[model samples]
Target: MKQTDEVDDLLTRAGARWRADQEAPPEPDLEYMLSGGRKHRRWVPALAAASVAVIAAGVIAVLPDPKTPTAPTAQAPSTTAATPDARTPQTIAQGNDDFLVKPGDKVQVSGKIIAVPGKTPVFCPPLAVPDIGYPPGKEPAPSCPDNFAVKLNGLDLGQIPGLSTIKGVLSGEATVTGTWRGGAIDVDVQTALKPLDHPAQTELECPVPPGGWKSQPSNISSTAVTKFLAAHAYQATGPIFRYPNGTSRGAPVVILIGLAHGDADAFRQAFEKVYRGNYCVVPTLLSQSDEQRVTNAIGDVMSGNPKLGIYSASGPGLYGGRALAQVTAYTPEVKAALTPAGLDLIRVIPQVRPVR
Candidate 1:
């Protein structure tokens, strides 16, 4: 057999051999739940692991009652990743505006190389593959006994260097660029994922005063603040930090916090007695608890898909009080699968979108 064909045979055999046991997803951290859920920047360990999404205790109260609902409102799908129509290989490669890549196209992707005991390593799109695990209707692929990830949408980085050295799962993360060969990514270049020594500086919403904001010792303990915020889940958001306009990425961070709704003077009155640093109280649109409630609701909605392997990640966005979810691929069928999820509180985005 040709050397390339020999390698292909090796991958086919390896993929058909291994089976993986599923780890039970983790439970929610009660404290994190109270701490005002974070933006996309911070990872909630347990929630990230289990992909916990909330569902309503009964029918969603936010949803309009089916019997007397007025005319359905039209919402344009949010992200460019969600296409106007179902994508095909030809459309993706031929139409520059259609999608990113297609069969036989060159592509570069970064992620971990996952290798189980008898299976050859396949490049797992660590970031692209949703932390939410398999979408609602799909089976766990690692447990399946078949040639896996050998498809156009997948990156099968066949037989990379160092596979002989590792014993368990994962080859860490790396940048891989290759030509799509209909079934696998024909490797062209590979390199380690470099760490960012210096990330772009971020600024505070409130401009720094002349002398700059300094952290002053607070008589109000952190635990006390957490307890206070926890009780006032309706209006309080946990403390937020940002660097002064030109400060380096690392800390001596400036801290700003807001508590549940109260008059501006009253907010100053409460904090002035305890806090020495700057803080602001803003109006609340939706609480973290409310976002979490709808988040879980959407989780139930997203899992309705039976077509399998549509990955997703979901959580609250940084600024807007809306919960957001990004699906790996979404079609009219998949959209149909996710029903009455029509809540305004949440937005569903598909990375591999179908165009209209």
Candidate 2:
């Protein structure tokens, strides 16, 4: 069968299988191999069935070849912009995993080259003995999570050779191998990396907003200030959102904070004024000093209802801000999954509140 025809058939079967499922599949694992041999793993499971279907079709052809010099040819959805000279370095890595470049580095039997660091590449760190797992049913989104895979991020090649099998399930273990040629290690091989442990589950009550007020968008009339407030809404501290099947419905008190210490009151007031009438809003008179608290809050809200997200300006209370706009809104996985649906995480740089 032609590759395209084969892909279509595979996709059709995968689609049928997915539709038959009573509930949606949990999010796939998203693996990031960062530059400079580092591997950082952030588990977010909000993938749709279509995403998996896409993989099911062409997956067989996207695995790394044990005898080829390059990795597989699968691509993942990415938000990061391409960097100049991203491949100037000889090594590839995730957040921390690094591999010294031997001429024969291509000996791995099978693996995905997730990303090639601008500097030296490294091995992905072994999965640490985990004391905890992420919420159940949500795994990192993976382009191809099956079989031995190789996902190199920086460099691009037309096609890889020697890879024979590619599916959408992780093998959970990998091996490294190489060949010797021309004084350099002909680093070509196949191996599998262990699939991450299945994510766990946590149950907690969604807290009601401190008061029965929801932030109203109109409260902040100042164009600049309102933008900050409108981007985030303080909803009533009761349940406003839920999972698709009413499995997980949570009410989380949300606060959109300003990036700077000085603007805390403005952001708080803006958020409070807008949502107050509809829902209770919590006002953090003082900017938050703890990231763990914010992470906890975000995790809590998302767990209760995967579709509700927090919006805030870049500042000390909030996490680091890099995207142009400090103000953005989204649900943990809902917003991210919406990327395929055309919802982008808006970035708003906080300007001086326009004089009324």
Candidate 3:
């Protein structure tokens, strides 16, 4: 996608759900790795079926608090409004589990601070872990139980405030401003990171018809529609937006299609003949098959590479053809791990980066 203000706002809002519920990320054991890594030809799990053009939420977790809540908390819909954080949008555009701060620089970043069982609570990157899960039906939204995941991301600190009293996981995102010293960041500012709701907006490159997307009368069965799309190189995309808000008919079905090889108008016309529902077709650079090919290659090659901390790997998205991988750090070893061809299609994201 073009990343327009609307898309940015939407993408940014989608991120706060990355904010664990109430703005906190979900639990640990968040294997960002495609579960079907062996099966390679799958769209990214990050893209939920709920909407098209929706990017996967950032992976993060929780820390211990004084009063430990034993039961796993479900990821909740966002309660707080998202505000622009005092971080670099350009850097965030780089995309590494939303760790906006670079090591060695005294800059502001957003993350989490959790308690260690017998140790003082230290501020750590809220990169999602392997324990907590997402709320039911909300695949991409991480669950925000008191027991969220918190990866140290190569830093173990004893610098957060009120550490002496913390007993269990600190259960929310925190705005952290600090500098990299030897190991941990030199703490400067620490505050709660407020959560934001998902922006329910989306757009298309093709102009709307004169009637403004009115339903057309036709008869197209689900099976025939599937066969037709597959015949014409249909690539499935994750759900991103709900159209025709407040329709009593039920949840609005808006189909957003991206074409890498065919003409957008022609594709839409062809699709109209196949199905009688709402849909928008736009031009794209890569096809789902192409993305699957590349991502499958990535899974094959990067599967067992040690110490690179491969958290998750996804196929191409609606925005671009490049696949995305969430890792612990973007290091030399990581850079050296990928085959040049794999590197061409994959974007490696780190939970935390060093002073570069």
Candidate 4:
């Protein structure tokens, strides 16, 4: 009985201890959840790596394209380099350099003969040859036009039939080269002509007297007249002179004579006072009525034979009227191509300076 009682008491005490343990607070579950969170952390790093790759792909799509190099283009023949009548050549040089002349453009030429391989003749515009004097006459003042220049030279009227047309002068297969230009064109041109050397040592000069005026022209003093006389004049002769057009017969000089009736005697005195040589004091005729004579005189001057120069003793239109008259008489092209600027037309007037 005593042993049974002791066992019961021990059981009771153990039970009491179990009850105390149950009454205490429960243990925290945080460590278990924390362990699970730590296990899944590797997935976060994997997701970050995938995001970085996607961002890099997007950047590449927005970049600009790179540039590549391009090739150069190709080059046509020059009018200056070819023969006057020859078909212009097509070559590399033609393509590279720009030519001043093209088809359908008018041009003026001034140059010397070098080589000619073609058959066509080249024509030059009228060159300025000063010293062809005006016709005779007595006037109050000088008869020379205000803008007249001593450099005024004769033009290439055309060819002289018997003497030498361009074909004969340049000869067959001749070559001519010179500095040529168009008045309106800004570029300087180098030109070539075929059949180069026909007009051998031909000379051109102003007209002389006696055979000069066969018939007096009524319009001689009109401003529209181109032919006139100068009291004192300059002359151009040859060696270098060429006649693309042929020469006229009779007076070998192409005279631009000025006429002024009673002014003739006065011009004689002026000529004597200003010049003394083969220049003689000739009496002015009442009428200079010879057109053929004048033309022949000019033709003779252009002929390559004996070089000659003409003198004008008298001039009626002087001072104010002289320039206007001259502008009307000699400036055909200028009148035709009138511009407000008036830069193309050259004006000449005699100023009181020491005559040398």
The residue-level lDDT of candidate 1 at 64 comes to 13
lDDT of 1: 0.36
Q: Would you estimate the TM-scores of all the predictions? A: 0.42, 0.24, 0.49, 0.15
Write one digit per residue (lDDT tens) for candidate 1, span 245-338: 4222221233344322334455556555545344544332234444455455555554544232234434332232234444333334444544
Ranking by lDDT: 3, 1, 2, 4
Greater TM-score among 1 and 3 belongs to: 3
lDDT of 2 by residue, 42-63 (tens): 2113222122322221121111
Clashes of each: 13, 87, 39, 74
Distance (Å) between predicted and true CA of 163, model 3? 5.7
Local accuracy by lDDT, each model: 0.36, 0.25, 0.39, 0.21
Task: Specify the highest-lDDT model's number.
Answer: 3
Worst 10 residues of 3 by lDDT: 59-68
Better of 2 and 3 by TM-score: 3
Residue 221 CA displacement from its true place in model 1, Å: 4.0
lDDT comparison, 3 vs 4, better candidate:
3
Lowest-sum lDDT 10-residue window in model 4:
317-326
Give the TM-score comparing model 4 with the true structure, all chains together. 0.15
